[model samples]
Target: MTETFQISPEQAEMYEAKYVPAIFAQWAPLLLDAAHVTTGQRVLDVACGTGILARSAADRVGPSGAVTGLDLNEGMLTVARRLAPDVEWRHGDAADLPFEPDSYDAVLCQSGLMFFPDPDQTLREMRRVCRPGGTVGVQVYASLGSQPAYGPWVELVARHAGPEATRLLSTYWAHGDLDELGRRFDTAGLVVEDVHTRLGTVRWASADEMVQVEIEGSPLIDRISDAQYTAIRNESRELLGEYRTDTGLQAPIGAHLVIARQR
Candidate 1:
C-alpha cells in the first residue's frame, strides 16, 4: 500500500499552500539565478511539487520562453496544473524523464532530487535531457545539525517515532554528503561548477505556528500519533522558545545548492 503522506493529493495541497510558500519558496530565485535562467530559455523543473520553482522559472523565462514541470506524483501534478495551467505539467519519474535527449536548455530540480529512488539514475536522466553546455541545478537541505532549530526538533520526534523518524529526517537532511554528491554527478556525466551552502530564514509568529505547519504540512505526520504530536508540540514550545518574540520568530535554514554542467 502507498503511504498517505507523499501519495495523497490532499496532503500535497496542504504542503504546497502552507509549508512550500512559507518555507521553501524563498530559494526559488536563488536556484533560478544559479542556472542563469533568462528570458526565452526552455527550462524543465523535475519533480516540481506544487510548481513553486516551475512557476518561478516561468516568470523568469517570460512569454517567449517555456517551462515544463514534471513529477511522478499525480497528486502533485494535479495541484501544479491547477495553479499554473499555462506551464506544461507532466506526470513522470526523475529516474526517467519523458522528454527527448538534449531537449531543455536548463534543468532545475529544487529540493526534489533527494527523494528519488536512485539519485544516480535521476542525475543521468536530468543530464541526458539537457542540451550540452546547459546547466542542471539542484537543491537539498543542509544536514540537520547545520540547520537552525532542527536538531532538537528532530530529536524530539525521534524520541517518539523511532526508526521512521530517522527516515523522515533522511528526506530533509538528504544529500548532506557533498563528497558523495559530487561523485554521483561525475558518474552522471556532469561536471560540478560550484557547490555551496546558502542560508534561508524560516519565520513564524510563534512556536505554536511552527508546530502547526510542521505537523499539518509535513509528510512525517503520517508516522506521528496524536499523543506523539501533542508531546512534540509541547516540547517545541519550550525548545524553540528562544525564537519566539513579540513580532515573529526567524530560524536560519541552510541548503546545499549544486550547479553542474552537462559535459
Candidate 2:
C-alpha cells in the first residue's frame, strides 16, 4: 500500500538540521560523478533535500550551468535557497515537475526516489524534463541486508510500528536491484546506461548522537507517541552499542547510483 506523503515545515527543518549533513557527505560526490554534470549544462534536482546535491551541482556547473532544485517542502527549499542562492529552488512534486519537456541537460536525485508515492510516475516526470541524450541519475539506499547501520533501526521500528513500517524502512522503489532499475528505465522510456554501488560509513560520536539524529528527523519518530519514542530510543541505544569503535560510532551504509539516458 502507498502511504501518504506530507512534509511540514518543522519536519523539513528537523531533517535538514539533523540528518542531511551526514547524508550529503555520503552521497553528493557519487551523485555528481554519476550525473556527469558539466560547466554549461542545465540540470534539475528533484526532491532536493537541503540542496546538498543541488548546491554541489551548481558549483560544478559554475556560472554558465544553471541548476533548479524542486521539492515539495518549502522549509527544505528555504534552506536550499539560503545555502545556494545562485541556484533556483522551487516548490514542486516529483510526480509532476513544473517544467517544460526536454528542459534539462541532466537530472539528479539523491536519496529521494524511494520516498515518492508513485516511483514510476516520478521517473516519467524526470524523463519528460530531460532532453534526448541527457542523463537522469538516481541515488537510493541499498537493502538493509547490506547496510548494518540502518538494519537495527528498521528492526526497532518494525517491532514497534508493525508491517506498515516496511514502507518507511525499505527502499520501496526498485533501487537496490539492477534488473528492477532496468525495467523501470524501459517503462519510463529511458535507457539504463550504468548501475553502480558505493560504500560509505555514517559516523556518530556516540549512540546518543545517533539516537538524537533519528528522533529529530526520522518519520519513525513522527509516528510514535512519547512513550513509544522513548522505548525505541532505549532499544536503539542498546542495539547500537555493539558497533561502537575507537574512531567513533560508525556503521556501514551502502547506496546504488543508477544512470539512465532519455531514449
Candidate 3:
C-alpha cells in the first residue's frame, strides 16, 4: 500500500537548517558535474530546498545562463530567495511544472524525486520542459541499509513515533538501484544514461552533537510530543554510540546519481 506523507512548515525549516542543507552541499558539485551544466545553459532545479543545488548551478552557469528554482514549500523558497536572489524562484509541484516545453537546457533534482507522490508523473513533466538533448539529473539516497547514521535515526524515531515515523522516514530514504530508476525514466520517455553511486559522510563532535542535530534539525523530532522527545533523543544517542570514534562520530551515507536524457 502507498503511504500517506505530510511535512509541516516548521519541520521543513528544521530540515533545511540541519542534515538536508549540509548533505546537499556535500553532493552539489557531483550533481552539477553529472548534469554537465555549461557556462551558458539554462537550468531548472525542481524541489530546490534552500537553493543549495540551484545556487550552485547558478554559479556554474554564470551571468550568461539563467537558473530557475521551483518548490512546493514557501518557507524553502524564502530561504532560497534570500540566498540566491538573482535566480528565479517559483512555488510549484514537481508533478506539474509551469514552464513551457523545451524551456530548460538541463534540469536538476537533488534528493527530491523519492518524496514525490507520483515520481513518474514528475519525471514526465521534467521531460516535457527540458529541451531536446538536454539532460535530466536526479540524486536519491542509495538506501537506508547503506547509511549507518540514518539507520539509527530511523530506529529511534520509529520506536517513539510508532506509525507516524514510518510515514516521515519513507519520504526521505531510498536505495540507488538502476533498474528501478531506469524503469521510472522509461515511463517518462527519458533514457537513462548513467547511474553513479557516491559515498558521503556525516560527522559530529560527539553522540550528543548528533542527537542535537536530529532533535533540532529533523522534522521527525517535532512530530513527537515533548514527553517522548527525551526518550527519542536517548535512544538515538545510544544508536549513534556504536559509530563513535576518537575523532568524532562518523556515519556512512550513500546516494545514487541518476542522469537521463529525453528520448
TM-score of 3: 0.80
Candidate 3 lDDT tens digits, 1-263 = 12424456576667667656445678889999988998999999998977888898999999999999998877788777876789999988898898999999999899888777788888999999999999999999876656667865776677877867756665556535667788889989998898889888776777777666655655777677887877876776677777788988877778889999876
Question: What C-alpha lDDT do the candidate models reach, one value each?
Answer: 0.84, 0.80, 0.81
- Per-model TM-score, in order, reads 0.86, 0.83, 0.80
Native-to-model Cα distance after best TM-score fit, residue 129 in candidate 2, in Å: 0.9
The sequence of per-residue lDDT tens digits that candidate 1 reaches over residues 111-229 is: 88777768899899999999999999899888877677776777877887785775665666878778888899999999999887898878787888877766665678887789988
Scored by lDDT, the top model is 1
Q: How many backbone clashes does candidate 2 have?
A: 0
Residue 96 lDDT in candidate 1: 76
Clash count of each predicted structure: 0, 0, 2
List candidate 3 segments past 4 Å from native.
1-17, 152-168, 203-235, 245-248
Q: Could you give candidate 2's per-residue lDDT for residues 63-180 as a string of tens digits?
A: 8889999988777887777778888999888898999999999988988887787889989989999999999999887776566667667777678777666565555323776677
